[model samples]
Target: MYVRTVYATGDPAKIDESLDALRVEAPKLLADQPGYRGYSLFADREIGKIMMGSWWESEQAQRNSDDHLKERRAALLAPFAHTVTVDSWEAVVFTPSLQVQAGAGFRLSRFDVDPSDVDLLVQTFKNTVLPKVQAIAGFEGMALLIDPAKGRGSVGAFFTDRAALVASRGAQSAARGEATAKARVTMRSIEEFEVVLVERV
Candidate 1:
């Protein structure tokens, strides 16, 4: 699996509105892309920093999406690019393994599971959370890594920018209330991070 991420800094006032726009617009725009799969977005409240993420079956699919025509794709993304910085990359090693350099702006998440409910947890994440989150705006891609043998898992997303990352949640605001309640029932521990760079094997 491969990931790409982008973000922006230096603009605080425009942050909230931009993030919300990404949450609502991205999925509707990118859902039909040939190699498209799923994606996620996030925000760091302290600095008003944002991250946009997308996941693809291979690095090539991601590259092709970038080849998208500007004029044609503008309607899908016109709202999220107000004034944000952007970066992209692929994942190497997250925890148990060492990482290789692939690109920039990669995010790695380590999720702890309940020993007694490990299998159920994995199922819920795949069946429940994944579908709901993928529909959000600024969500260009997503990938989930699981190790049932060890009862642990890791998930990643590719982004366009910090604004997109922050706005991802907004894209699904219509369903946010219900999604939150469901997550509280299923998740054990969720950890979020910022990836500086990545290397490939």
Candidate 2:
């Protein structure tokens, strides 16, 4: 699978409005696109930050949507966001216990691995970290994305709600730390967000 992520910073007050717009617009724009699989939007109202992601069946399919999505993105982002960052990645691992929906909590963790150890890192994640994460209370799903050429990867873990998220943090952190060290990866950053919208095609 291929994934595209858009990060933006905007007016906190307008965040809900922006998400509502996306909730209405994404399906109309993406539902019939070739190889379109799903899409989701997350936000951190207090920080005025939002992340929008679209999933595709393949790299070519993802690339094919870029031109069509460009204008839509501009229109939605222009009024609210002052800073925007966009990235694409290959989905390495995805485990969804339930369909993604509003009210879910997400924790995004980024890592930098040695280019030569990319496969090892991925294997370690699947063999070790993932099982532990799945066993956590309220665990809902997880997605791991990587750019092998750049040795960069990100993990997105979801929970049923904020309470579940908080309850699992300590165990999640410990497992992730061990996995990263074993894989010779460097932990970069982590961010939290609330899922506002999701659609699977």
Candidate 3:
């Protein structure tokens, strides 16, 4: 799968309005696009930050919808968002559970690994970390995306709600820390967000 991510920061007061607009408009605009799979909108209300991600069947499908996506983003988010960062990635590991949906909480972690350790990192995550994560209470789903050549990657873990998310933090942190050391990957940033919108096509 190919994924496109947009990160933005804006007025805290306007976040709800922006999300409301997105909830109404995004599906209609992207529903019929070729190879479109799913989309999610995440937000950190206190921090006034938002992250929107759309999944596609391939790079070509994402490229095909680029223009329309850009226009829609401008209409719904540009007015409120002061800064926006966009990126694309190929999904290396995707494990979805029935518990994942709107109202879930998400924890996103970015990593910088040595290029030579990319495969080991991916394998270790699947064989060790993922199993432990899935066993956690309220665990919903997870996805790992990477650009192996650049030694860059990100992991998104979904939980049932805020409480479940908070409860699992320590376990998650320890697992990630071990994985980081084992894979020789540098842990970058970790952020928490509410899953405001999630659509699977």
Candidate 4:
């Protein structure tokens, strides 16, 4: 599977309106597209930051989607978003045990890795980090997306509520350190966001 993430920021007051367009109308545009699997939206209301991720069956399908929705995509965000950035990656680990809801707690951790250790990083997550993370209280699910060529990856950790997410911060950091140490990767940033909307097709 593949994941394409779009990051955007603009007026904080326009956050709600931007989310509506991205979650409601954007899915309509993607629903019928080949290889489309799901869509998830995250937002940091304080900063007016939005992160949108869409799942596809393959890299080709993910890339081709840009050609199909280029103009429509731009127009959709024009009213509310001031700047946007996009990234593509392979879904190395995606297992959602719980269906996310509006306001669900989400934490995104990004890392920069040595391209040569990409495979090792994947293995370390599966063999070590996955089990440790699954044991965290209120952990609903987790997914690791990576771009081997760029040697960048991100982990999306989902929790049942804000309290659970807060309580697990220490554990999350420890696990992150362990994974990066073993994989020879460096942590970039880790931040929390609220899940605004989710759609599975």
Candidate 5:
């Protein structure tokens, strides 16, 4: 599947309001679109970072979504967000898959990959990282998203809760390190978030 992630940042105090729209309104607006598959929302209330990933059956469908609800999206987010950004990626790896649970924990790791080595990097993720991540006690699922043209990619791990997310740090780090070295990709940022909602159809 192809995914489009909307990133919004603004008033930390209004974070909940922004998330509420995505959890409720945004999905409704997207449901009727062609090739729509699902939506997953994540947030870091402390920093007022809100990210919602919408899944589509193809790259074209994903691209279509960006224009499908432009007006409504702006209206819904403008009150709380000062800046909103969008990104699209092809899902290279989705293992076991991300489960939908309001309070689940999602840990996201960003990377700057070698454009020419996209396939090698994906294999490294599936082979070098997936096994270690799956071994974590609270692991639920994992996904790897890549933008070959931009040399950017990110991987996310879903956990049962905060404790599980915290406990799995060591192993996750080791696996990420190996993948980074082997794939010749630069690891960027890593942060954990609370899953607000996930709606699939």
Candidate 6:
């Protein structure tokens, strides 16, 4: 599947109202469009940020939806235009084999794997962590990717919220103590990042 993420920034105080509007109205407006799978809205009051993400079967589906809504949603969003910045993009590495719960949000976490432990790392993520995550309250989905050319790796995707991610992260770290220790001995480093823009799709 192709995924698109858009960030709309506005006054922190207004995030709740904006999110409420989208949660209640946007789906009703775009539900039947071709290739449109679904969407989720995220609100971060502390940072004055709001995110909108959607999944589509193909690039064409995204194009169609964007074009169909450009004129109409533009007017609906005008009042908040002054504080919003919109961005969209496609996914480079994605896996559809995983299952996630409903009503979840998204996140992008980056990890760098040590070459010697790569295989073990992959197995643990696919066989263990992934399952535990799927069972969480807003657990949505995730993608684990390796940047062979760059000699590094990363995971970017979604979660229901920061708390869900926190829980999963803790459980995974603890569950794989021995294996994780072995990997860490050969480890380079790891970092997590939030996806801010999805430009292509």
The sequence of per-residue lDDT tens digits that candidate 5 reaches over residues 60-144 is 9988878878788888888789999988999889864456588888999998998988999888887778988988898988899
CA lDDT scores, all candidates in order: 0.49, 0.87, 0.88, 0.87, 0.87, 0.56
The regions of model 3 sitting more than 4 angstroms off are: 97-99
Query: For residues 130-161, could you state the per-residue lDDT of candidate 3 as single tens digits?
Result: 99998999998899998777888899999999
The residue-by-residue lDDT of candidate 4 on 108-132, one tens digit each, is 9998999999999999998888889
In model 4, which residue pairs have backbone atoms overlapping below 3 Å?
none
Error of 2 at 39 (Å): 0.5
Pairs that collide, model 6: 88-198, 88-199, 89-198, 89-199, 89-200, 106-158, 107-158
Alpha carbon lDDT of residue 150, candidate 5?
95
TM-score of each: 0.42, 0.96, 0.95, 0.95, 0.95, 0.56
**lDDT value for candidate 1?**
0.49
Candidate 6 differs from the real structure by a C-alpha RMSD in angstroms, to one decimal, of 7.2
Off by over 4 Å in 1: 69-85, 93-201
Which one is best on lDDT? Answer: 3
Candidate 6 — which residues are off by over 4 angstroms? Answer: 81-106, 110-140, 143-162, 169-201
Identify the runs in model 2 with alpha carbons over 4 angstroms from their true place: none
- Give all candidate RMSDs, comma-separated: 13.8, 1.2, 1.3, 1.3, 1.2, 7.2
Q: Any runs in candidate 4 off by more than 4 Å, and if so which?
A: 96-98
Q: Please report how far candidate 1 places residue 65 from its true position, in Å.
A: 0.6
Cα displacement (angstroms), candidate 5, residue 93, comes to 0.5
The digit string of per-residue lDDT tens for model 1 on 1-201 reads 555555544355555565566566665555655666555555554465666666566778777775662344333334434444433444432222233221212334555444565555545656665576666554544455544445545556544455555565444333333433443323344334343332222
Clashing residue pair totals per candidate (backbone < 3 A): 33, 0, 0, 0, 0, 7
Better of 1 and 5 by lDDT: 5
